[model samples]
Target: MSYVLAKSQNDDIHNAGECGGAVTSIFKYLLDEGLVDGVLAIKPGDDIYDGVPTFITDSDDLIGAAGSYHCAPTMVGNIIQKYLYDKKVAVTVKPCDMRSIDELIKRYKIKKENIYTIGLNCGGTVSPITGRKMIELYYDVDPDDVESEEIDKGQFIIELKDGTEKGVKIHDLEMEGYGRRNNCQRCDVKIPRNANIACGNWGSQDGWTFIEINDEKGQELIDGAKNAGILETKSPADPAVEGRLKVEGIMKKMASKVQSVKYPLVSEMDEWNRCIGCYACRDICPICWCCENCELNKDYFTLEENSSPDPLAFQGVRLSHMSFSCVDCGQCDDVCPMDIPVSLIFDKLQKKYYERTGYVAGVSDDVKPPLYSPEKTEL
Candidate 1:
């Protein structure tokens, strides 16, 4: 067995695209500590999977590990599912990723001993669909042409191999769906609960990071780094981190917004009028469409095969019914070509479900999700 720790330092937070250095550092630390036999993470490459899942046993392989803020890293989830069949694997994920893992653990789809998680504190994530399209439309660049990338101060910087560069400022891309992810807009779990160690931009004064070890495993990794002299722990903030306060302020504002608005759910059945019955939302969801025996896929909603008296009629029902299965990760809304707010249904359901059942779907694996446990039935 070996050690696993998730660490990243990327401005984009899309998929660990920018933090190749930080990811390599952690993998090296784990190798030294002998806590992991292998690490599962995304690495940059020229293959079709430019940002594809990688299993690194040799420390040298980790050099290719990178970071991004892309929201739909479904490959990470698929990798976790696949590897759980064998040895323990350490993985790096953002807050949203952590939540999905928590949900999986509850379903007994993954075992704790077989997995070690490192969570990155997330401010938000970008839709990769939008990212790829923006590059193609604005810069005439393909997703593979860029060697590396980052998003900061409202600018999308793509470093190309031809010594050519492409940059789109946030203002220019504001109407371009740059900051659109259903879960991000309503996310309350800024700090991930499934991680053994959490790292990110939360406590730093400058662009540098302030890593926080949350568990014994995390502590071991950090301590090993200190012993190896790969990293140095500094004193607490002097006047406190400047952006820390700003982040707190913005979260409060978002919380208020969540409270002020009503979420749409399939249970309501009235919110899906805009839906053309295209099933686009279902196809794009990261979680709900996991099964091949999908009832919706068989056109079970229609009176006849491939027939619907009214296509949009089932949209609201579909969303409300699927709310319970939703982690509020927002793939449904992000994928809607019609710009329908499918996530709003999950958001309201999450709030209502949390209030009624006092449960959060993907917080931790320490206990079963409250909805699934009848040992302490409130009813």
Candidate 2:
């Protein structure tokens, strides 16, 4: 991997994007050069807190996708699988997004050659509704008046349209159940190294993005953007690199602590009693693409007349099918009507599987989960 500090050459992108406009500029370069047919990124929804994923075919639309929104918890993996599988696209991905994409690629749901992943270093994300409430309760500001939000140095910071900013300790907000999503709090993958290029503000100077080139494609992206006069780059200083690593280390430690406390054994959970047999978790799971022929749909597993099916039989069947491949993107948790920590058990199972096989789902391309492979015979 190679590390560098980069920024956009476009004045408007540099001024508007988060940290620097490297990401936006890269997308512009890709579109202008015909390297990709489209770009998928999050654009502002009704407000800063409401972010929606948008597909852009025109380079002019890249500006709308500039900046970061911590409240945008949408995943891009499924969108690529379901919509852009045949199209060449560039997308910005968080760790979870990259993980989901990797898992989908493994399942042949997405074509690896058709997509380019620009990875972002993520701390965590807050649901939009919870974010609005947190701004009102903790920041003492009207959620509607807020212009932007960020997570930095253990604080949840928000900037108002009036150019005023406020910050609250993340630990304090989380104690009151107002911080990041539970799965995010427990997520240890801070950097999306599985992508072609990973960019973030952690190690760079002000107004620049620290970029880690993970592969040949990432190097080509940087070189092409620079040659196209859309981006500028320089080597990062030693101190800045060290500081970034320190920040990543601290975030991982926090995640480990959260995981210990939040993920109880599946046998110990009682939230299953509230399940309404909605199957939302199964439907939302990125790895669960066998909806029509799912084992859970079989007559033996179905409750034709009852609203709630046996949790152990229903969720258990899913866990066995693809829990080892679960990326813990938390779509399941987010959609569950019963507010059950559905992803927790899946995440725990993946972790347990990792302990036994040294396999981390979606983190590396070289290793495959044992379930998908067959036994080898020796002569």
TM-score for each prediction? Answer: 0.71, 0.96
Per-residue error at 322 for model 1, in Å?
4.8
In candidate 1, what are the lDDT values of residues 140-215, reduced to their tens digit? Answer: 8777676556544335577787867778774466455554354565677766645877665554534344455667
Return the TM-score for candidate 2, rounded to 2 decimals. Answer: 0.96
TM-score of 1: 0.71
Which structure among the candidates has the greatest lDDT?
Answer: 2
CA lDDT of every candidate: 0.59, 0.87
Which stretches in model 2 have alpha-carbon errors above 4 Å? 265-269, 303-309, 375-379
Clashes of 1: 24
lDDT of each residue in 1-379, candidate 2, tens digit only: 9999999999999999898899999999999999999999999989998889999999998999999988776579888888888999999999999998998888898988888899999999999999988888887778999888888999988888999899998899999998999888999999999999999999889999999999999999999999999999999999999999999999999999998887664552476667777889888887887777887776777567544458777776777865578887888999998888887878887888777666778895644676665642221
Number of clashes in model 2? 0
| Reference-based lDDT, residue 249, model 2 | 99
